[model samples]
Target: MIDGSPLVPHIWFNQSVHFRKGSIMVLKTLQASRVLVVAYPGAADNEAYRKVIGNLEGRTVQEETCKTATQGEVLRMREKYEHSPPDLILGIGGGQVMDSAKMLRVLLENPGKSFANILEGPLAQRSIAYVAVPTTPSTGSEANGTAVIKGSDGVKVPYVTRLMVPDVAILDPSFLSTFSSDQIFTFMGDTFGHAYETMVSKLTNPLIQSIARSIIDLLKLASAELRQTPADARGLDKLMQAGYLGGLATGSVFVGVCHALAHSLEQQKGVAHSSAVLSLTPRCLSWHAETTKDPIYSHLLSEFESIGLQSRVSPDVLAGVDLLLLARQALADPAMKTSPIRMKEQEMMGLINWILKK
Candidate 1:
């Protein structure tokens, strides 16, 4: 059982086993016979996934493919499987797929409740087991309990519950082979943003700080390796491990301005999460550094320089956009509450303008 003032979920990492072997071991350990496999629509026919599914020889498996993790999708999934709930809900893919599975498990456990009920507070502990198999090195949804799903209004909504944490998380480097070097760099930026935000969060404690620091170091190493050899298995493995640690750290301490701004960009402009976060990271860090004398931001900047990572937001990207509205939206985000330094709407606008200018 997870113990402490704040609970941390159990995570597992292995380099030797393939996905097929890993799935079998997890299912056997949970004594699960009926499984609900949730993944991206394209993942269902992938050869790697086919091999993994084939390992469930004697068990019953039902597959669901989702394009995005939305409230409507969660409701539909719950309605489809409510009568015959699976013993295991396995999420395989990136953050969206894993988040869909997490929310699906929430609805399954609640029986007749609507997805909106989650906004009130924490739900009861779910009895259905969940296993997260992340195909991407970003998001770290496998090791985290919070799920960011698109609301009916198209805004991103985050639901948090310790009970939603996955029962198991499997990390395999083979999955990283699918991404190009640029994609890998973007994902690494997301990982670094998570660690940086959490490290500077007001809720951060010694344990969270340690995890965040270690994650930053690992990301630096992975970034360096990927710069030279993008497909290095060992480097990708380190990236995966850093992603997991970053997830766990943020799971407890949460994020601040960077995530808040990125969520707005994602919802309003349909910017990819990693790209938005990466673009805003330098400005957010600069804002924090100006407000406080914390050495962490400076240290992160130096590390970025060492790794040859760029953190400027391009002006052409935000051309013909309403900076005022986006800044207001970001200030309203719940993530803003965790920021070590708070800002008003005007300050947020100033920050947004500064980022655009960089």
Candidate 2:
């Protein structure tokens, strides 16, 4: 809607995406007698959750709260629901919560398969329906099928299955009302990174680029508006819309080096994924520009500067991390497969050095 055709919003999905201020009301209309809600720890106290849950009064609703999504948690969730799987799963939180719900839905339908099993092979088609309700306007998990869960070995493993996309996605700006100032910037950074990376991905095409550019435009408008009015409803709607479009772009193409590095940092140092992405995005953009001498990459870098996005990651926090190992992990990320440059391990190390300005 921001910059593309009217059909642009609905072209990417056969599924329903309710994008409005009070879209949470749509949750009450879903036909499910048995429901499972995988949510953030404090979601029960939130007015949105309370209203939705209250509306589903007669339905048998089970709740599980997760602060972080890990393979262990998914396994535990599977064990809890394997016997009597919910007919519908409502993922009502941020990216991690939605991802947990997606995996849970997959594992429940697949039967006896763990995250390890799915990662090793193709997943069976999703049987049960699930709806995604994202509280944070980041990761675009609500719009995409990819789920990155931390493994037992402390590396995040990405699992992709076409069937993993939610049957419905609800984007309600009211849910974003409680985010702190730090959270606002960090999450917006993630959305920007998705758009930027998609723009430069090897799998990118003209259509995907249009979606990515639209996301960037929406982010710019949202950020500028939010700067003037912290609680601006229009800004929140724009951000949520941008997030969904970014999801469409990333799901169609890929996110390359910035996300690769961010995933490694998240698994290795327990850093916030968005902070790592925010810190690495500008660096990766410049690296791509200098290494490839492409105007596209340089133009992206200029656009990043113009947007005035900033990262909150502390260089001191990364000082203790093993840069060499981090580089190796980044190169090993699935996202790297789509990077414009297929850097060797040593090259990755050099990029890491530049990223840290060391």
Candidate 3:
């Protein structure tokens, strides 16, 4: 057991595993003979990925790129490899790539089942092992069993199964250097929003709350440092750790209104997930403060201020959003059921108006 606990999965941090020799040793340990690599389009050409792939000597490796974690895309991948499934699946990139890998494992295990059917029912035990190597510091998909994939009906669908969690998660800060300053901030926004939502959710227990608070503190420190030096490896590592903790908290207690709204915006409007979270989280916090009288919001506001983030939504960030539609769509999300206070249509509209205020 790592860190004296058997509950947490094995995780390697700030490791020099991107090198050829290290990669070979890691793959050998996993006994990976036939390996399938699912990565983002840009990641296909990344030097880090290239080095790792090159080191997989004497192994049969197949590579696929996923632009989005949609049901259709996952189904296609399943069809392609139906006759001969890989012994191991490695997800290399950000949340979408990782989520694609997690979902693909399910599809491969249960052939001919629709994504909806699989989500609604219990999954068969996963046959293959998945290893997640995140290129970004957001989402922490590598550490959790939840995958949020876009559905065939153009809705964001979340699939959770203990079987979907990766067998291994690798964190390397070198990949973070690829992101620009704006991209870094957008990802940081996601991390912050996730921590906030997890902390304020009604399902939060004492253990979950402690983990959530630690995630927030780490996010605050990492983001503050990144604002000045976007390429700081130590800061990036901190962000990755915080994101991992956020993922644990989310998987443990689940998220609330902010994620519900963000998922809806991403599905309906085709907005980027991080952008949606950045635009909506502050407004969700305000709504909670007004209706629930939760002390978590005030504490979150202070943390946001400390990290140079505004405590309210920025209108410019969501200039063209249709508030009414967003509110209605968000209500359908399962996340709403766990909100600290019940959200009626009137309260939902109020949250929308709060987001729109200049």
Candidate 4:
């Protein structure tokens, strides 16, 4: 265990047993054999997914594959096509696909309504059973309940709340085998961010602390294996599991600056979510140290050293380099909120200047 506890996040790990083993637990959960599988066209073209799709055959099912779907389109699919609130909405891609299912389920639950209303104010609605099957690891859509909806003007708007966590999320290690580490990796930054941010949050508790430690420890082990041998399946599995743990922690406490910067850029500037997050994380970590170093920096330093990043970046330089990276993220980010740490605008600009090197 990284920090000797599972309390950082609340997850039904037992769901994995049922998902992988094809156990009857699924049957018990779904009274109706009918299922709705949603994926982007890209996933539909994937040969690797054929078997899973085939298994769901012979039942009442509706498959939707599209480039993009608006909230209105999702609602119309349900009301017009009579595809009522599905017994289960299975999302088979990254965040966009996952958000589609969540919105679909939400619309179905409240007939004649759509995300427009949900965005207008607080939602009285709760979660309907949505199962998220992640093809890529970084988005963590399976673990969180917030969604970004593109408005009529082609701008994304966010609806943040706790109602977005999927009822079930299935992470298959085999999926990682198909990905080139250089193509798209769930970086170890989340391992540190989730733990450190949660620790720094006013809501930190003994349970959250325990979960954070476990994720950090596991991430260190996984990162080490990847460093030694990039294609290690055993190593990939640990990395995937660590990502899962980070998701659980982030969903509970929510990420701090690294993610906040990503959100600002993606929503306001239309930056690609993965690229935006990857770009901003280091800076936030640097600024974070200036603001918080107690148990937070202590824990972060230990995790980074364990993963072999600390030696490359001495403790003396971590804050400087990380801040430089994060500042570029903010400048490129179309938006951001002043964190609880209260870094001034001038200070933030200074940090940005450091990140935007020639």
Candidate 5:
């Protein structure tokens, strides 16, 4: 629909915008008078949430903090909202809470459908105004079209579709001031994966390249500054923006071996999602570049070279072959089917070896 690209434009801004970057302005355009804000664990007790809620002048707000939600717990939440769902669903948290909100939204719109039925369809099932407010610099769930739920195997199975994209993303810089340096780095790697996959996607389109480039550039800038200095609001804001844009870009498109590899780690290796990306992202890029040799896979590789990737290839990268095996064992993501270039076991081993030797 958008020039043959799967991505949609998601408006964004935080403290870095000299002028209004349009996130709040877009919210005002929705013309909805009532809003129910569902927040993640620990948000309500924090003064930050209170301060933010206080600033909203006339909007009637009821704040509910979601404790760690289980599968059954989510179903109950949906049941409560079924007869009388809110006018708008505002999700405020990391992946888990955001994803739960997405499911609730879907189930509420299509009554009598089993949750399993809801999972099978593309996200465009119906129209519901959804606003996403991310408090962390990671996960990029704020703008993505997919909502991942933990499956029986404990792996995240993503619900994918065009309609799932958030109507608005509110990325207030003040929200992420509490993250440690490690969290910022892990999230930035995710932005890198988004850029890499979209650029090299078997389904790559010319239209999303500029947005892909922006993700790459933002990650590069964020990576350098965060590695050297302490994480601050400004750097955190840019990193989150980069990751947010990356998710928006790749949610329609998707990250390739890196994310698949990360998924594997998530299921089998017991790694955090952020760590999965950080540990394998660079290696995945190296392997994909060498294995696919895609002439069009341009942006991320160039950024890698610019950022001393040529000099700092690691043993884990050299071990990409092992990781790929895990990826196959761990993940069955759709992106794997459409990767611009695919990798076999031998090629993956070669990538890891190259990285380790470098």
Candidate 6:
């Protein structure tokens, strides 16, 4: 019901997003007595996360951390808390941990149903509140409702529903200070891809595009500031804001052909998600420019080049993979449907070949 009208395009936030310095104060506002905290290993040792625990000292708290966000892990977590579900599920990590938190929340609320069953059918409203505190600024999992969990077969399955959106998002930029310069770029590269795709997404309207543009601009400023002063608080704060806006925009309109191709590479070669995304995004931009013959696409590519991201993948990663099959898989993703250009199978294959070569 929030900005759900069909007449205009507006970014809808189903959660309350807080951009603040401390993470503990947000916990006081939640109406939860029992809390299950799913966090990254060693996260609870940090000051912010520790303060969160301190705030809820008298409340029941069970903390769990998993290395991978997979369906089996979620199912196991589900069984552990099935009889006594927590009133709030607090996710405290990067994308995978946050994703695990979302899946755990969903499965706990709906017992006796498989993940696939819930993904395929209508889901009931969630009773347990979900609060997300992102330890990393990359995925923007806090602002969004989609959880991409790897299945048993290793394919990343995306479960998209408004029901999965966190009830609150606590973005504390201090967590970003610990990231190395190289790590910062990797995360910012992911953010750039999100903003770039959202700007040109077929599902985008004026409102979404405006926010996307702001994200890109803020990233540019933050990148320069971080380069001059590593881990500058002001720079990281701006980056955090950009990350949140990137999530809001991409979560609304969804990513496009770049993500589609990146997903294919990740599936076939086990390339890291952000690495594949950074590697293929510029090539996707080039393809869009050539195919659409649009000046805006060309300009966007120039702006993206200014970000100075280095692709982390080696050339041999695609060695023996079938370009045609890869193209088909990339095209098959639902993300491709939101692309500005609808490429044919052959055309997509050509782009893949070009990407690997260049």
lDDT of 6 by residue, 1-358 (tens): 3424222354547567788567547687678889999998888678777887787777899999877789888888898999999999999888899999998998888886787687665566778999988888868888887889988887787777677888899888878767788778777877889988988888888888888888888888988898899998877888888888887887788888888877887788877777677767777788778777988778877777776664442455467777887888888887887888878898887787777776
Model 2 ranges off by over 4 Å? 1-14, 119-126, 311-317
lDDT preference between candidates 4 and 6, better one: 6
User: Candidates' TM-scores?
Assistant: 0.90, 0.91, 0.88, 0.74, 0.78, 0.91
What is the C-alpha lDDT profile of model 1 across 14-121, one tens digit per residue?
222223223334444446899999988888556657755876668898999988988888889898999999998989889999999988997898875676576454
- Return the TM-score for candidate 1, rounded to 2 decimals: 0.90
lDDT of 4 by residue, 259-317 (tens): 55555555445555555554555555655565556555655655555665443321222
Better of 5 and 6 by TM-score: 6
Please give the ranking of all candidate structures by lDDT, highest first, separated by commas.
Answer: 2, 6, 1, 3, 5, 4
Q: What is the model-wide C-alpha lDDT for candidate 5?
A: 0.62
- All candidates' lDDT scores? 0.78, 0.81, 0.75, 0.57, 0.62, 0.80
TM-score of 5: 0.78
Best by lDDT: 2
The sequence of per-residue lDDT tens digits that candidate 5 reaches over residues 1-358 is 3222344433222212211122344444444566667788778776656665664447766666665334565677777777767777878787777777766677777776655676453434455667777776666677766777765455566676545566667777566657776566656655666777776666666666777778777666766776677665456667777767776666656666667766765556456676666556665665655666754444456676664333433334323245556645533665565566556666545654554554
The clash numbers for all candidates, in the given order, read: 0, 0, 0, 9, 5, 0
Pick the winner on TM-score between candidates 3 and 6: 6
In the predicted model 5, the residue pairs found to clash are 202-340, 317-352, 318-352, 318-353, 319-352
Mark the regions of model 3 whose C-alpha exceeds 4 Å error after superposition. 1-25, 119-122, 311-313
Residue 49 local lDDT, model 2: 82
lDDT of 3: 0.75
**Which 10 successive residues of model 3 have the least lDDT summed?**
12-21
Write the residue-wise lDDT of candidate 3 on 132-188 in tens digits. 888877787887778988877877677776777887777666677778877777777
